[model samples]
Target: MHPIIKIESLSKKYKDAELYSLNDFSLNINEGQIFGLLGPNGAGKTTLISMLCGLVKPTSGHFTIQELNYANHASKIKKIIGVVPQEYALYPTLTARENLHYFGSMYGLKGSHLKDKVVETLDLLGLLKFADKRIETFSGGMKRRVNLIAGILHNPKVLFLDEPTVGVDVQSKNAIIDYLKFLNQNGTTIIYTSHHLAEAEDFCTQIAIVDQGKIYAQGTPSSLIASTAEARNLEEVFISLTGKNLRDAI
Candidate 1:
C-alpha cells in the first residue's frame, strides 16, 4: 500500500531570513501509525507541518497526502485531513456548540449531520456538559478539548496535531491522548509534533528527531532509544541529538 503521506526534498526559507526553516526534508508516514516529530524550539517541526497542511507554502520540494498533491488537489487533500494547531483557533465569544457547528460546516457537513457530529465529538471529549458555554468561560483544558472536537467533527482520515496537550492538566492530557489513540486505532493516520518527549515515547509508534532543519534520527521509540548510547528514553535521545541549550520557544 502507498504511504498515507510522502514528502520529498522539502525546504523552506522565509523572506530575508538567513537560514532555511526546513532543509531537504523527506519522509514517508505509513497509514495507521502515530508518527511523532520531536525536536527543540526552532527545529522546524511546525514549518514542516504547516507545509504539509497547505497552510505554509514551501520554498522548494513537494509533498502528497493520500496521493493527492496540494498543487492540483488542494481541496481534496484538505477534505481527507485534519489540523489541530498549537494555538486556539476558536472564537472566544462563541459557545462551544456554535463554534463546532461553524467548523464542521467548513468541511461541508451541514444540517442534522453536522449537529450530530458535533454532539458526538463533544461527548467523546467530555465537553458535552459545557456545549452551550462560551469559549471565554472555559478553562484551558476545556478549550483544548473543544478545539480538538472542532478539527475532528468531519472524521478526517489523517490528523495533524501540533502540541495537542500543551498547558493542560494531567487529566486533560490523558483524555486527549486516549482520544488520539482511539482515532488511530479506528484507521486514522496521525502525524503529531510535541515537546513532551516522555509522552511522545509512550504515544508514538514512530518518531523522527529533527533539528536545524535536519533529521538526526527516525524510528520506533524503542529503536531510537536503543540506538542512542546510554539513552534510556526518548528524552535522552532527544537531548543527545538536539542538545540542552534553551532556544526560547520561537
Candidate 2:
C-alpha cells in the first residue's frame, strides 16, 4: 500500500526567526494508521501539520498527500483531507446544528443530506440533545465533539487533528478517542499531535517523539517504550529522550 502522506527533507523557517522550526524532517505515514506526532510545546508539530494541510507554505522541501504533490495538486489534496484545528472552529452565537450546517456547506454539502449527516454525527458523539443549543452554552467537551463533527462531515481520506483532547474531561477525551478510532478503522488515516502520552500510547498505531523541530524517536508505542533502557511507559520514554529542560522562547 502507498503511504498516505510523505514528507521529504521538510524544513521551514519563519521570517525574522533565528532558527528553523523544522529542520530537514522526512517521514512516511502509512495509510490507515493512527499516527501520533508527540512533542512538547513549540516542537514544530503545529508547523509540520500546517504545511501538510496546505495552510502554510514550507520554506523548503515538499510533501505528498495521497500520492499527489502538495505544490501542484493542492486542490485535489484538500478535498481528501480533514483538519480539526486546536482551537474551536465554531460560531458561539449559533446553535450546534447551525454551526454544523455552515461547516458542511463549506465542503459543498447542503440540504437534507448535510442535515442528516450533521444530526447523525452529533448523535454519535452524544451531542444530539444539545444540537439546538448555542455553542456558548455548551461545555468544552461538547464543543470538541461538535468541532470534530465539523471536520468529518465530508468524510475525507486523511484527518489532521491538533490536540483534540487538550482541555476536556476524561469521559470526553474517551469519547473523542473512540470516535477517532471508529474513523481510523474505516480507512481514514489519522495524524495528530498531543501531550497526552498515555492516551497516545493506547490510541496510536505509530508514534514520533519530536523536539526542537526534529523527530527524536519514532516507532509503535510498545516498540518505543521497549527500546528505551529502563523506560516503563511512553512518558518515561518521552522524558528520557526530551529531558527536563524548559523551552521558553520569547
Candidate 3:
C-alpha cells in the first residue's frame, strides 16, 4: 500500500534565523499507523508538523498527504486531515455544543447531521454532561477533552496531534488515549508528537527520534530498544540518541 503521508528533503528556515529549524527531513507514514515523532525542545518536531499540516510553508522540499500535494491540493488535503494542537483552539465563552457546531461547519457539515456528530463525540469522550457549559468555566482536563472532540467531529482520514495529553489528570489522559486507540482501530492514521515516552511506546506502531532538525532513528519501539545497548525502554533509547544536553531555544 502507498504511504498515507510522504515527505522528502523537507527543510524549513525562519526569516533571520541562524539555522534551519528542520533540515532535510524525510519520512513516510502509512495508513492506520500511530506514528510518533519524539524529540526534545527545539528539535524541530513542531516545525515539521506545522509544515505537514499546511500551517507553515517549507523553504524547500515537498510533501503529499494521501497522494495529494499541498501546493496544488491544499483545500482537498485540509478536508481529510484533523489537527489537535497542544493549546486549546477554542473560544472561551462558547458552550461545548456551540464550539463543536462552529468547527463542524468549517467542514461544511450542518443541521441534524452535525449536531448528532457533536453530541456523539462529546458523549464518547465523557463530556456530554458538560455540553452546555462554557469553555472558560471548564477544568483543564475538560477543556482538553472538548478540544479533542472539536478536531475529530468531522472524522478526517488522517489525524495530527501535538502533545494531546500534555496536561491533565490520569483519568483524562486515559480517556484521550483510549479514544485515539479506538479511532486507530477504526482506520484513522494518527501522527503525533509527545514528551511522554512511555505513552508513545505503548501507543505508536512506529517511532522517529529527531534532534537538530534531523532524524536520528526510525523504527518500531521494540526495535529501537533492542538497537541501543542497555536501553530497556523508549525513554532510554530517546536519551541515547538525542543526548542529555539541554536544548533551550527561543
Candidate 4:
C-alpha cells in the first residue's frame, strides 16, 4: 500500500529563531498505522504536527498528505485529516451537542447527516446523556471525549493527535485509548505525539523517537527496546537515545 503521508527532507525554522526546529526530517506513514512520534519538550514533535496540519508553514522541503501536496492541494488535504490538539477547543458555554454541530458544520457536514453523526459519536464515547450539558460543567475527561468527537465527525482518513491522553485519569486514559484503537482498527491512520512512553509502547504499531527536529530511532516499540542495549521498555530506549538531561524551553 502507498504511504498515506510522505515527507521528503522536511524542515521548519521560525523567522526569528536561531536554529531550525525541524531539520531535514523524512518519513513515510502507511495507511492504517498507529504511528507514535515520541519526544521530550521542544523536540519539534509539535512543530512537525503543526506543519502537517497546516497550522504552520515549512521553511523548506516537500510533504504530501494522502497524495495531496500542501502546495497545491491544501484544501483537499484538510478534508482528509483530523486534528485533536492537547488543549480543549470547545465553547465553554455551549452545550455539547451544539458545539459538535458547529464544528461539524465547519467540515461542511449539515442537516440530518451532521446531526446524526454528532449524536452517534456522543453515544459511542459515552457522552450521549450529557449531550445537552454545557461544556463548562463537564469534567476534563468528558471534555476530551467531546473534543475528540468534534475532530472526527467528518471521519477523517488520517488523524493527528497531540498529547491525546494527557491530564486525564486512568479510567479516562483507557477510554481514550480504546476509542483510538477502535478508530485505527476501522482503517483510520493515526499519528500522535506523546510523552507517555508506556502508553505509546502498548498503543503504537510503530514509533519514532525525535529530538532537535530529527529522528534518532524509528521502529516498533518491541524492536526499539530489543535494539537498545540494557533497555527493557520504551522509556529506557527513549532515555538511552534522547539522553537524561532536562529539555526545558521558555
Clash count list over all predictions: 0, 0, 0, 0
Model 1 lDDT per residue over 1-250, tens place:
4599999999999999999999999999999999999888889998999888898999999989988998899999889999998899999999999999999999999999998888888888898999999999999999999988888888899999989999999999999999999999998999999988889999999999999998999999999989999999889998899888989853
- TM-score on alpha carbons, each prediction: 0.97, 0.98, 0.98, 0.98
- Count residue pairs with overlapping backbones in model 1: 0
Task: Output the worst ten-in-a-row residue range by lDDT, candidate 1.
Answer: 241-250
Distance (Å) between predicted and true CA of 204, model 2? 0.4
lDDT of 2 by residue, 197-242 (tens): 8889999999999988899999999999999999999999999999
lDDT order of candidates, best first?
Answer: 3, 4, 2, 1
The candidate that wins on lDDT is: 3
lDDT of 1 at 178: 99
**Per-residue alpha-carbon lDDT of model 3 for 90-119, expressed as tens digits?**
999999999999999998899999999998
TM-score (C-alpha, index-matched) for candidate 3: 0.98
What's the CA error at residue 63 for candidate 4, in Å?
A: 0.2
**Prediction RMSDs, each to the true structure:** 1.2, 0.9, 0.8, 0.8
**Alpha-carbon lDDT of model 3:** 0.93
Flag regions of model 4 displaced more than 4 Å.
Answer: none
Off by over 4 Å in 2: none
